[model samples]
Target: QVKYLNNIVEQDHRRVRQRTRSMLGFKTFMSAAKTIAGIEMMAMIKKGQLNIPGSTPFEQFYALAG
Candidate 1:
């Protein structure tokens, strides 16, 4: 049976898959996991979920980094 409920997951994974396709080699699972984590983190930041108080998204990253 075809499950339509997982469409949301497939949609979310599309970007991640595209990102991985661009990259060359991942030596191991740990490295791949780290890459995915970084991709998701950027996605959250872009969505403003990780924005710091009183700062725009771009500024928030700078604040966190510096």
Candidate 2:
């Protein structure tokens, strides 16, 4: 049970790690927070996690941006 739960958590972290790996690192806390939030938002859109009522992820993201 514990191993199963840990795998689930690790999978999620893997996505974040892959995305951030090219950036080297963040210089400030605020910048890191914003960048991570944007990354997560994009990931959610790609995963169809947001219900913005759009046929495509780009449209959904635009709606949220406005």
Q: Which lDDT values do the candidates have, in the order given?
A: 0.77, 0.79
Cα deviation at 15, candidate 2, in Å, is: 1.7
Task: Give stretches of model 2 more than 4 Å off.
Answer: 1-3
Candidate 2 structure quality by residue, lDDT tens digits, 16-54: 889889997999999899878777778888777886763
Model 1's alpha-carbon lDDT is 0.77
Give candidate 1's error at residue 1 in angstroms: 16
TM-score of each: 0.65, 0.75
The clash numbers for all candidates, in the given order, read 0, 0
lDDT by residue for model 1 (1-66), tens:
567869977876777888999889799999899788777766778867786778777776656545
Q: List the residue pairs that clash in candidate 1.
A: none
User: Which prediction has the highest lDDT against the true structure?
Assistant: 2
